[model samples]
Target: MAADCEAWLNANPVEAEDLSDSFISAEEDNGGSGGTNKNIHNEINGNWLSSSSNNLHEARLKAKAKRRLRKNSSRDSGRGDSLSDNGEVARGTPIAPTSPKSKLLDRKSRMGKGRGLPKKGGAGGKGVWGRSGEVYELVEVDKKDPNFDEDQENCVYETVVPPLDERDFEKTVTPIVQEYFEHGDTNEVAELLADLNLGPMRSEVPSLAVSLALEAKASQRELTSRLLVDLCGSVLSHSDMESSFDKLLRDLPDLVLDTPGAPQLVGQFIARAVSDQILSKSYIEGYKGKVDCEHARAALDRAAVLLKMSLGGLRIDTHWGTGGGQRPVIQLIKEMNLLLKEYILSGDGKEAERCLRDLEVPHFHHEFVYEAIVMVLESRGEKTFKMVLQLLKSLSLSSIITVDQMRRGYERVYMDIDEINIDVPLAYFILEQFVDKSFRMGIIGVKLRDQCPHRNRKRLVSEGDGGVVKFERY
Candidate 1:
């Protein structure tokens, strides 16, 4: 019985216990004592039944199991009754032998869940490295036998990505797509490319390129608006794709914007353009006058924030275009001023200060700092002015001190205008600078209304002050 069980284990593989169970059960019914039970006749075909049929019953069980086996059958089908070696399918059919591996892969994948390894073969002691492309092998269910390797046999795959056409259209297509994007003409491009194929798109053109484009569309829409899109074509020159690209990039909001790296690409282009102007600074700036490379810098900034870009990636290679003698410090201050104003309008003092810190324009002089102080102090309340002074004097910019300054300033000048017994006219002009920065320099003055232009503007003049006069129209 031990030998029999061992034989069964070897031939049938104890791992497939259900098969073992079936054979054992049928054998017990036939009486293991070398005789066939009458019950066996009805359960199995009678042609092989024997009076001394324990052997016959065993033969029947084996035969039934072989017939039911899912693996290769070339094993025992010799005289149309006996199996040949290695249990293969009968010759002449194209179907290959059904190994334990191929069968389970088919079954498991059908369940909508995928499995990593197969049940047998291509691993462990004997049959591993069995085929090419079998990079690694895994162990069997009990870690008993070699199980699976994702070799050519196991990991059958189908490559569907269309091969890149080295010369056909990529060069032409890449520029066209970029240009269209720069021009804010994606809708036009999409329309033109509608129903178009890369050569010829399959119905599966749910293919990669199309899918990527689809994923990119929603973000593009959110970042772009019709007004800004028009600005791209109008404010930015069509010939300089960098201009349009930079414009679009700058329009992105500080929060909830497009992918971070996006600006880097735009920035690279702008940097290149600026470098070009720099390389040709004599001739180009002579013609263009004070080149607005600010757009380019902004594009680079957007790209850096969006793409998390590295400076090494930029390809700036331009010679000077103009103002060879003038340093960019003044221009940098102007840019910083614009940014600062926008930051204030957006109610983000923190970012405005950071911008001031990062300003690296070589021309930034003490005068610029002094100008900044005058502008800040004159336009803001006395208390607010003090806070600006404190922030400048502080070793490191601190938020707490800045807040305290603002609170004191607002309370002092804004809340108690009447106590000063000051000239109402001078007071009106003095306070109005908070509304328009130019008021600080006496270049222009502002009117105060509680609401904005379309609505009411804040009233800069104090209540019951005879000097109060409403501000003028735009």
Candidate 2:
């Protein structure tokens, strides 16, 4: 039997204890031995039952542990599946419950915010992170690759400008000045000059303009000269341009004197301008009315002097008339002076008649000499007063300037007595002498107003403190 047991044990070596327990339990149930065997069977049966119960309890515990493991595994796998929805994961990873807990916690944390923390990504949602806690980095989309150097090899940048030459200068500056002269648009002139970088040379603009005009065609020369005159007129119209025009006009004398043949050219220029009616006597008078009198006088005087100087030495090729054989610029220069003098003695007829001999245009003699007698009365100069009286005597003898013309002339020069600048008594004396002479000459209908028209006249009688006497006509 022991040999058989040994063979059985060897046959089932791994389950030897289990087989022995079962065999012992079966033997206990049979009850085939004596009292000693029976007692042993009873104890063995009790031990077998306890061992079986313990084995069943252990099996249940193992099954319960396996179920718990499966449930937990499914829960972790579901969380891993959700995370897989977010993105794929690497293989063999024992997914932890941390995924669902972390996600739920992350959601709850986001909801509890007051002022929220700044998001992980900035503008354009760049560099965002995934739900799986993975990072997504930003990269250049439209920008050229900074790493490439192929374009740099073929490109270059130049900083230096080529120098401007004379041809280009003429091409650029000539049209600008010409347009200015034509339209008389000062702002356009300024803007064009500024574009050419010539704004800094503004003081030389007029001279440069003149040079350009001389270089222009003869057909356009008259227009250019007229433009210069208009430019001067516009410039002199403003108070700020007074000094500029003065400076320009002052510079003209030197320009004429220093340059050979310039005066003759200028003379021809003036003759053409005058004939074209570009330089009108009325326009010049209007310009003089606009500018300072001193400047106007100086400019005219300088031009006259320049012409006279030209006549002194230079023999210009140009002549004034076709067959009249007149000198070109000399007559115009004299005419300029005569016009200035006529302007100076505008209202006084007696002075106008006396100065009429100096004027070439006899048509204006009536306009100029209409107030000669009044001019003599208003004269502050003793010589001018006597000369005017002598002219009136000669006119009275010739019966040219009649008593009616004298009356009209007197009425014109007569302002208020207080406004008169000459000595009142002396003026009255001169007037009395003229009246006595008119009476002796058998001039009838000579009218005269006695006593000052404006009663605000004062006289010095005795050359003392009480000499000043105020007279009022009643």
Candidate 3:
């Protein structure tokens, strides 16, 4: 019967309409037992429908179960079973979730493996673990090592400068002092001194500077005095200054050989230094009786006289007197006039040259030139004119007055010739003669000759007389 049922199910597919028709036909054919048959047919139909639905549900459930089994198998394979201590597999062990730090370490370990780096327990790169069973310790840098200097390891070095000696100091400082004389900049001199390692020879600075001043012009002496004052207590200590002045006193005889007035100048320097506090009061007193050299004694006496003056040591500052450009313009003019007047009286070219040198106004030589030419023009006697001309010639030949200065002087006279003519009617004639003479003597250039002014001569006719008087310009 089961075979028949299976064969019937396989041959005829179940349809709702066909099933309903079969139920209705069975009900009709069994009408005498209709109620019982109808009940039975309903039961059979219900069972068949329920059985089909159940079979579909069972099939879906089986497929889901199979998927679950396959997933479990894959998951279990990926995380193989852990072994017990007895070597038996342990089932159903929970895996704890991996932390981020552990995961990163795991990834690093994998990367290290690819690079052929040893594991944590094995020795490999620097500072890594040793491969031996016993862990090897890392070697530390020993502090006692002969070449070890932690500070020096990171330090940078600079080049060391060698010290300068005495002869070298003199050679270097002489030009420096000469330059100071030219510019008279004490601060600049101080900066230059600071650069040098004067060492123990620092006391030599004042002596050398004063010595140079003694031989130099008054302007240089004044500058040197100021230099000593500025450098005192700063570059040169009080002791250095005293020793230097002592040395200068001892060397005064030698200094006087070249400069006859060295004693007086040294006296002035000593007084000035003492007044400026570069040297103490005892500096002069120390040599009062002990100074055996006549020059040194004279210097000390001069210093004593200066200190005893009403103005006290203050007078020493002006001891050298202001010469060069330091003097007032009017004072300079007066001095120059005095110099010219003295030259006129004495008629000594050497004395005139000496006075000009004492003036120390090389830059103002043009003024001297102008004064000389004007003096010649104002003078009446030929001898005076010749004397002035001779002086100009001497100055020109000696280069005491440059050609540029001579030309400028002549040009100045020409510019003011008309005014000069108002004062002295014969001024034009005298200037013409002077220019011609100077040009002939090669004291001035030809440019001045061409520039010489010519006076205009006019002809006058007497009224009603018809007589012509020719007015001639000298």
How high is each candidate's TM-score? 0.20, 0.22, 0.62
Highest-lDDT candidate: 3
User: What does each candidate score in C-alpha RMSD?
Assistant: 23.5, 26.3, 21.4
lDDT of 3 at 152: 74
What's the C-alpha lDDT at position 393 in model 3?
A: 94
Q: Model 1 compared with the native: what TM-score? A: 0.20
lDDT for residue 119 in candidate 3, whole number 0-100: 54
Give the whole-model CA lDDT for all candidates, comma-separated: 0.40, 0.46, 0.76
lDDT of 2 by residue, 269-386 (tens): 5434333444443323444446454433444544444445555763222222211112244554455346434644563545544444333333333333434444545554555444
Candidate 2 off by > 4 Å: 1-384, 399-404, 415-418, 421-444, 448-459, 463-474
Give per-residue CA lDDT, model 3, range 55-130, as digits (tens).
4433444445556556545544544574433556646542322353654565343222355545554666687556
Model 3 segments beyond 4 Å from truth? 1-148, 151-160, 310-314, 457-474
Clashing pairs in 3: none
List residue ranges in candidate 1 displaced over 4 A: 1-263, 266-330, 339-347, 362-365, 380-383, 393-474
Please rank every candidate by TM-score, starting with the best: 3, 2, 1
Candidate 1 vs 3: which has more TM-score: 3
